[model samples]
Target: MEDQTTQPSPGSSSAAYPRWVLLEMNYKKNDEDEDSSCSTPADVKTLAAARTTSGYPIQVSLRLAEPPAASCVCLQLQVPDDVDVRYPTVVAAHGDSVLIQVTVTNDLGGFWNATTDHFVYNAGAAAAEPPREPSLSMLPPYYITDDYSGPQAHQLHTRATGLIRRGEDELVVAELSLKPARKDSLELKTAELLLFRSGEWILKRPRMSYGDREFGELPLWLHTDTVVPIGDRVLCWVNLVMGLLFCDVFEESPILQYVQLPMDPCYGKPSNRNVCVTDGGGALKFVNIFPRCCCGFVGATGCQRSHGVYVVNTWTLRMSDMEWVKDGMVDATELWALDAYKGLPRIPLSHPVVSIDEPYVICFLMIEDNKACYRDQTVWMLMVDTRSKTIQSVSLDQGERRWYPDTLIPSNVSYYLNSYPTSRSDGTSKSNGQSQIDIERSLVQVRDDDASNSMLQSSCKLSAEPAVQASEILAALQEIPSYGLDRDDMLKAAYRILSHGNGHRFRSLLSLPRNLRKDWLLMEIKASED
Candidate 1:
């Protein structure tokens, strides 16, 4: 073989010399001829294996044969999983190597086994080197929980009161909590009272001093009572209570007037009186006042009429000498012969039930029929143009059913009957033989655009563009049974046909008004259709 070892200068322009030699040998061989000679191939192989025995505990040392032109050279070592390597000492050829230890985990429960194929040094040569494998260990455990016991556990209650005069104005009172629901950590910190009116909630006042502390009492119930409008004064009563000590708030103001009513009775105690702080209008006139009595008796005696007291406003007008009609109905009294306004007019019936909406007063007549106790008893609402003193009776078909006017949508009212007692004839009565009325009520708005009113007016008019007969319409309507037909429904259908250019035909039958006669026909038609 040619001489493979040579030494060359650092910067010499010559071919590179071999720095190290690579040897390859097999670990096992099979054959008797391989071991025949004293220095057989098998013996040579055995010696080679002994020299490269990686299983034996061996110490590896590295040294620099010559200083490199550059000061630094990166050193990397990789070992198999089955092998254990430790670095006792390390020195920087130029600087230092960062020492780091890491441990990895394997869930398979098997020994980590790894092998190495080759490695590269300086990107110039490659050799068989150990592969890098991570150290393994066991994973740890973790846990979590939630607990609360601070100032977030309190409850609240509310109370409200109000008073109103028939035509003048109204007074409202409301109270709220100063703190949040939780009382332990958070206490009642001041509170603000807000007035919800005319589509907006405006901050009225802020109450700071409530029985002491800057934030007020811990178990305190803040209250707000005020007279609203501040003008057009009226007579009214209010009593409300909200159960809460601390309350959460978004905003507050002190511009609103706050009156602290005595807490002896808490609610509206006529005895625990408040003054009208507002101005204008007439002097405070005491109208018809009815006391609200609780269901319990007073002073440990039998049930009395004046236990828990409240007052409701009846009417407020500058009139004297009001006559009280002893009618069984709640609202049926008349005022007559007033000096300023005389013969003004008395309510048609003995008692008149009236609901006041600003300038308009809705009057209804209560009819009591002892003969038809369970069947025909009804309440009739008589539409009255109070200003003109004109009256029109509105008969309810199912008057025996309980009915009430809707407050929100005034035009729409609801009617319902108790179904528990059951109808005796229908076996709807319970075992006790008490029959409950079955009734339901829905909302309805008056159709002002309805053609019935116009046609009826035209029929009565003498110089109408096209004269329609009132008698003819009446005759046609009278033929139909009026038992189940709703008055508005019949009138509505009649108006529908009349509007479709039937005025001449309606007038030809001058005996009855087209509106009336058509209503009658429509009633019959509806009954037959049902």
Candidate 2:
């Protein structure tokens, strides 16, 4: 419909090198297969079916335009709304260029929505990001062999060293082919990742890993010995390789400031894995949630016998010293652990979600059937405030929500505010006590009156209020009469008002009854999720 090229904004340096232009509205695989029918202005069309997930082929194609001279051109494959897509891959022709590859990368596995789809191909442009020095370890492979085409390929060896760039992160991978190096005794490799700072190799992680060459296990794991550069400092995740899985992170400074994830009563064994190390905003977030299940002992007397879990732990990497740039969790970071309280049967937590607008984690609760040891399965919204360490459970009866059989999760307001401006958790640190009072006063429900508007103008900040006073705001929101509407309808009204900056809340959630379909009377934000 309209052009949506990955162009810099008007205020940006208009001198963007190797500009992209739209020449045609579609991509045609052959003379007969001509279909120009994608919505975005990039005008992407079906190239080839690389792989299929949920019966949807991962198709790969290019925009009908010249490649950027400064970088490799990567584009997002805009799947049509009518497609039953799942985890898919890109396809290439029999003799096509060997560059096409499939990527299914989401911290919570792969699921892209209509608004926040991440299908942009990274054409390996160092200038695209703020920092200049690129992840310089991606290289092509060189074959060291004779008659490598036939089944005698085992006689040949291959070696390579190069950089691989995912969306915002990069990795320097190195590989080598050896001459009968005895596939039994492991080949040990040791090296160090050095960051070339103002001309010095600031030492990072020392590379050390044993390659199980017999089974083709890599000698060095990718993240075990790695250095990722955040803002001014580098976040280093180093496996000490000292018989234990304990890793040390040297943050900001290599000599002084550092934190070690130690072993304890539960995670003392190296076997307890570090599931992920996320750049939470910039807080250097790490997860160690390992959940396992086992069959019960013969004739054992336990409540958790029928369940598939015992305990779960989720730790947030909080910054103790705040002198440096302290960034933490962003929106939608998932924390998955089947941690049903011990001896109380399994909780089987589902739809786990880290908050976007708040510093809390919320999930829907599940209960064991016909169990008497613990019967508070009526708890609906299990919320854990990471900052306050407060675990508050909102029972189904608390909201009188038990009568509504159609209700799934206690509909929350955060989902609708994903696109709306939210106060950052860090914004609270910037405000004084008076500013806090100003925030609370401005949050009273916007009444439809000049006197109320004048009162709000005197108390409210000229700009947006920080998220420091979210609890007060939620209280204020609750005081407003729901009038038979749920949180979903309230959020829809809030979205409409914020988007258009007009209309009353209740009326905003409603439209003139559709002539054909009265079901459209109320707006549905997440139809599928509901």
Candidate 3:
């Protein structure tokens, strides 16, 4: 492991740097990594190598012994010793555990090859045995639920399930199913839990309890994009487009607690621009990257279109009030004005992931604008600190596969890397257990019967002051001398937005044309810095 005392770059937080890593789930496998010539030893004990004796074909691990600079690490998914290298897809991640899946085949040509040392045919036994036809039964794909205790191999023959480890040998596999309550009606649907525990799988169909909502029914199209085990006995079935459906697997009768995400009017649809992550300190944060402008540029007509710049917003789940408290917001205009952004390419950014160790820090993937597809494009990961309004670090990522934002996740698994049992003290585990219990209890009180209310108000929450009129806003915009936009076109677009009775305080300077917006925006950026 690298020296723990290595200090971070000059402008970053004074706190311990590299507290967490930007984990790339796509494991890089070379030809040498696949040794089909070797067979699994019968008594292999360490997790350092691949194993098939446990019935699973692959194993997952987080390799952080000597981390690359800029707080980045690659998640290692060990391929079966006798099989070809296959990619492991990360389904969900919370804390130190990650849910992943990898396909496997029954073809064992490597085991039957005569060159292998273990390939020995008994002449006497072969003569008595009848010719056996090649079997067509392929082994089921492996779904791995890795825990902090270490990766354990389990053969789960199903999909859409997340595992939570309770102890060395105890684990729970929870799957969420949402379907119509009856075959006759498609509108009335029910959510059910399928749990695997104590060596048996049981389906729990609890009574449906609706939470506070204007619409008193489940989303007709609530597509579960991912499943996350949030801690304690609670797991969240998330729909990035809509909201999160949380359930406590330990309950005698588990109930779903629904929490709606703050809606962004610009997109109005779901995309990979948003992500949900947990702080190692036991807090759930939802980070969103608005591909449009959100600062003082609300009146700009073309801001909603893809201009390659964006605004990043973060909200923390106040488990107390069941409300999402807005944590922070940073606009690209402000970032571009800083010296840190000058050296970096002006590529488009996607995949907003918040750090597990430092909630204020966010990581993004930048891709060139000319690349039609991400297949072979060069990608860079940038870590930005919202509180300090500075770039923490930037690193080039070179992997041999297609890249996407979902392929990267924020995890604290590195914290456990070389510090497995022998290096860690007993007190560390006790403190972690206590912290987990505290976070788990935060979800215990979230009941479904609570009065349904609007979880997120409009982006611009109007105040009690008298409403501002369109004419007044237009008058202010007309005063900007360097405006390149035509007077009629600008007035029409500004009026179209402010015609609504809601009092939206429009900034005339921010509504300038692209060429003019930068000049005025930089002035305001410098003013704030002063």
Candidate 1: misplaced stretches above 4 Å? 1-191, 194-205, 208-237, 240-252, 255-530
The pairs that clash in candidate 3 are 212-452, 213-452
lDDT of each: 0.24, 0.26, 0.46
TM-score of each: 0.20, 0.30, 0.59
List model 1 lDDT by residue over 329-370, tens digit each.
111121122232233222222122222111122233334444
lDDT of 3 by residue, 371-401 (tens): 6744566667777877456787776665433
Task: Tell how far residue 378 is off in model 2, in angstroms.
Answer: 19
**Would you list the rank order by lDDT, best first?**
3, 2, 1
Rank ordering of all candidates by TM-score, starting from the highest: 3, 2, 1
Q: Which consecutive 10 residues in model 3 have the weakest lDDT in total?
A: 115-124
**RMSD in Å for candidate 1, one decimal?**
39.9
Query: Candidate 2 or 3, higher TM-score?
Result: 3
lDDT, model 3, position 428:
38
Instruction: Name the weakest run of 10 consecutive residues (lDDT summed) in model 1.
Output: 407-416
C-alpha lDDT of residue 452 in model 1: 43
